[model samples]
Target: MVSISDYGDFYKMAKRNIMLAILGFNAQKHFCDTRERMVSNVLSSLHKLVAVDPHSPLNFREVYTTELFGLSLIQNLGEDVCSVYVEEFGREISKEEIFHVLVHEILSCVVEPDWRDYFPYLSWLPNKSFETIVSSTEFRRDAVMNALIKRQKERIARGEARISYIDFLLEAKNSTQLTDHQLMLLLAESIAAAVDTVLEWLYREIREVCGGKAVTEEDLPRLPYLDAVLHETLRLHSPVPVLPTRFVHDDTTLAGYDVPAGTQVMINVFGCHMDEEAWESPGEWSPERFLGEGFKLADRYKTLAFGAGRRTCAGSQQAVSIACVAIARFVQELQWTLREGDGDKEDTMQYTALKLHPLHVHLKPRGS
Candidate 1:
C-alpha cells in the first residue's frame, strides 16, 4: 500500500487540476457567452419551478435514478409529474443525494455517446441495444445543443446579450484538437467528482444537525459544533475511500524501502482516515476536535476526503456552495424526525468502488 503521504500528494494534484478546469469554465470570457445565457435561463427556470411548487413531488433521487435507469420521464414529464415521482418515493434529501443527481444529469448531457461505446455493459443493463442507446442519447444531446445554438443565433440577431458553456466549448472546438471522447471524458470526470464529494460532505453535516430545531443562516456562523461533526464524519467515513491507482514511472525509495519502477500504487484513504496515529478516538464522532484551537486537526491532510496534492477536487467551491444552499434550505424549510421506535439505530452506510452513501433513514417532516 502507498503511504499516507503519497496519497496526500496525489489528492492535492487531482484537486488542483479539477479546480483549474472549474476556473476555466467560470472565466467571464467563457461562461458569459450567448450559448451559456440560454442554458442558464432554462436551468434557472427549472430551479424556480422546483422552489415554488411545494406540492411538486420531485427531489434529487428521482432525477438521478431516472437518468441512471435511462427512463423517458425526464424527457417527457413536466415539473409537476417530476415532483410527484420524488414525493412518492419519500427519499432522504441530502447534499450527497443531490450530487448523484447532478452526476446523472451531467453524464446524460455530456458523456452519453462515448460512455455507451466505452462501456457497452451500460446498455445491456438498461435493456437497450448499444447502438440504440448511443443513437438515442446522441440524438437527444444534439437536439438540445442545436436548440441552444439556435437560441443564441436569434439573440445575436435581435442584439440581445447572452452567455453559456456551449458557446465556450464551441469556440474552444475551433481552437483546440480535443476529440469528442476526450471532451466527454473531461466533462464526466468533472460532474462526477463535483457531485459526489459535495453531497458526501453535505449529508454528514446535516446528520449532525438533526437533533437541532432547524438549521438557519443565522446558525451558519455559529456552526462550529456542526462543522466538527462534519469533520469527524469525513474522517470516519470518506466518500471516496480508495485513491485512484498510480503507476510509478521510475524506480523510487520510500521510508527506506526500495520499489521497482512501473509498479501500481494504491492508497487506502479509508485506512488513513481511521489511522490511530493521525486521530484521537478515530472511530468516534467528535466534532469538537475540529473547531477553534483544534482546527489543526485537519492541517495534515491526514483526512484524505478531498484527496491531496495536485489532483485535489477542482469543484470544491461550487460543491461546497451547493451543499450549503441545499442544507440551509432543508434546515430552514423542513422539520424532521427519525422513524418511530428506530431513532437509536445507527446510519447504515454502504460503499462501492467509487463512492459511499447512506443506505436509508426514515425521516418525516417536522411540522407536517
Candidate 2:
C-alpha cells in the first residue's frame, strides 16, 4: 500500500537494488574490469570475423546476454562457472537455455485474450498447451534460480566471501522482505533485458558523440541522439509490454464506458505507444521524433516504455541508464553489419517481444 502522490519508498528500494546487481557507480568498481575485458574480447573477435568475411552470420543470443547480464552472473558472481545450473526442486539446466525460458515465461504472463480470464467459471479447466508451458517454464526458472541460491549457500558455508548480485541480495533479503521466489524473479528478469539487438546506427551515434573516444556513463547525457535512440527503442520493442494490473477502488468511466469498482485493470503499454493519434507514424522507427522538443518534461507519455504515472516501473531510470551506457560503450568500441546472405527477412522473431532473429553480423574495429 503506497500513496499515489509519494515515491520516496520506491526510490529508496530502487537505490538499494543498484547494489544487488553489478550496477551503480560504487558497486561497478569491483567487477568492471572483468566485464569490460570480456566485452572487449568479444567485440574484437567479432570485428576480426567480419573483416575476414563481411557477410558471416553471427549468433547474438548468447553474445548479447553474455555481455550485458551473463558476466555479472557467471564470471565473478555465480559459483561452478563450468557446471550448469540446477534446481533445489528440479534437475539441472544449461546457461544457454536460461534466457529462452525467461522469454517464454514473460510471454505467458502478458494480458492476452483468454477465455479463462473473461469467464471465471471456466477457471477449473486448464489449457493443456499453456499448462505444459507453465509447468516446464516454472521448473526451468526454478532450476536456474534455485541452483544459484544453493551455490551462494555453499559459498557461505565454505566461508568464501563473494560480491555478486546473488550474494548482495541474500544479505539484504531479510531487511528488504525479499523472498527466495522474489530474489529468483529479480535475477530472472535481469537476465533477459535485451537492448543490443539493434546496433549499426547506435554505433555511429556513439562514435560521433564521443568524438572517437570510449563512451562512458558520464558521456551518456551529452550524447543527445543516442539518448533519443534509446527512447525510440523502448517505445517500439518493449520487452515487458504490460503491467500486472491494479484493483479499481471505485466506479469510473473509461472512454465513455463504465468501469465498476473492484475491477482488475491492466495497462497495455505497447498499445499506448503504438497509438496513431499519439504518434505521427507509430509503426516507423524514428529516433528523430524524440530529439529537441520531444524530450520536454511534459512529453514523456509518447512512449510508455517503462509504464506511466506513479505505478510505473520503479527501475525505469536505472534500466534506461544501464541500456544507454552499455550500448553506447559497445557501439563506440566496435562496429557491426547486417548479414543478409545468411538468412532472409528476419521481419518476425517469436520471442517475448517479437524481436528480430538473433543473427550473426560482420564487425570491424572502430577508431572510437
Candidate 3:
C-alpha cells in the first residue's frame, strides 16, 4: 500500500522544479493519476504492434522495447504523449537518439575492446573505431536530451501543467544544487535503464508463467513466478555488469588482498554473480532456486543490476513497478518464441552488458 503521496521528496521535487521547468504547480496528483494509466496505454500499444505483424516472423522484441517502451518512458518522465511534440529532429539528429545511447553509448562502452581499461597508463593509446562511435553517440544523446529539456521549459513557461520525474529534478535544483546537466542525464539514464532491462528480461519464463493471457496488476499477487523470473533475470544477466568506479576511504584488506586508501576500484559484479561458490549452476536461469529459501537469495545478495550500497538506484521501487507492468502485460498478450533455427543462439555478452543481439521473436496472439 505505497501511496504516491507517501513519497515526500517527490512532492518537494515537483513543487520546486515545476515553476521553472513547467508552469502551474499542482502537478503531483496528475503524475500519480497518469502513472498507472500511461502503463495501461503502453500495454495496449504493444499488443497493437504485435497484431499488425502477426503470421510473419517479427522483431517484436525490438519494436516493443525500442519504440514502445522507450517512448512510454519518455512520456512518463515528462511529455504530453509518445509522439515527439517538438519538431526538433533534423537530418543530422535521429528521432530514436535515446535508443542510440542505450545501444551505442552504454552497451558499446561496456562490451567493446579497450586495453586502456586494464592498463590505465595506456589510456592515451588510440582506439579510433570505438572513439568515433562514442563521439556520435554522445552528440546524438546530448542533442535529443537537450531538446527534451527545452520542450519542458517551453511547456511550463506557457503555463501548461506537466508533472513528470524531470520536473522533480528541477525542483531539487534550488534546494539540492542539482545542475541542469545532472537533471537531463538522470532522465536519460532512467529511460535507458528502464527500457533496456525490460527488453532483456526473461520473456520465455514470463510466457510460461502467465499462459498467454494478459496479466493485469491485480493478477500480479497470484503470480509469484513472475517475481521469481525477474529475480533470476537480474542474477544471470545483470544490466550493469561492472559497477561504476569507487574509491577506498581507508586502507583495508578484502578477501586476503590488501587495499590502500585513494585506490580507484572497479567492482566486477558479473563475475561475482557467476562465481560457483555462491550460486549452484550459476550460468543457468533458475528462478525456482529462490523458492523456500526465505529471501536468502544469497549470503550477500550478489546481484548488482541496479547497483548496491548507499548509491543504489534511488528510483528502484518505480523501476520495479514499471518492469512488473511491462512483463505481466507482455507475457499475458503474446505467444513469443525465439526466431526459428536460432534456439541455440544464446544471449551475447558485450564488455558492458549481456543481452540478446538484435532480438528477434515470432509473436503469435494468445488464444489465436
Using lDDT as the measure, which candidate wins?
Answer: 2
Model 2, TM vs. native: 0.75
Alpha-carbon shift of residue 171 in model 1 (angstroms):
1.6
Q: Candidate 3 residues 1-368, lDDT tens each?
A: 01112225644553334333322324323343444565567556656766786656665455555444444454445553333333445634334644555445755664556667788888888988878767776666666777667777777678775556675666556876767776776566555544224333445445665656555455566666677767777778776677766768789998999999978777787898899997888988777766665557454356777666545644454455556767676655656666776545555665445346555676665678
RMSD after CA superposition, every candidate: 11.5, 5.1, 7.2
Question: lDDT of each structure?
Answer: 0.44, 0.62, 0.59
Instruction: Give candidate 1's TM-score.
Output: 0.52
The lDDT ranking, best first, is 2, 3, 1
How far residue 79's Cα lies from its native spot in candidate 1, in Å, is: 14
RMSD of 3: 7.2
Listed in order, each prediction's TM-score against the native is 0.52, 0.75, 0.72
Where does candidate 3 stray beyond 4 Å?
A: 1-53, 67-77, 80-94, 101-103, 110-114, 122-136, 195-214, 293-300, 351-356
Order of models, best TM-score first: 2, 3, 1
Residues forming the 10-long window of minimal summed lDDT in candidate 2 = 1-10
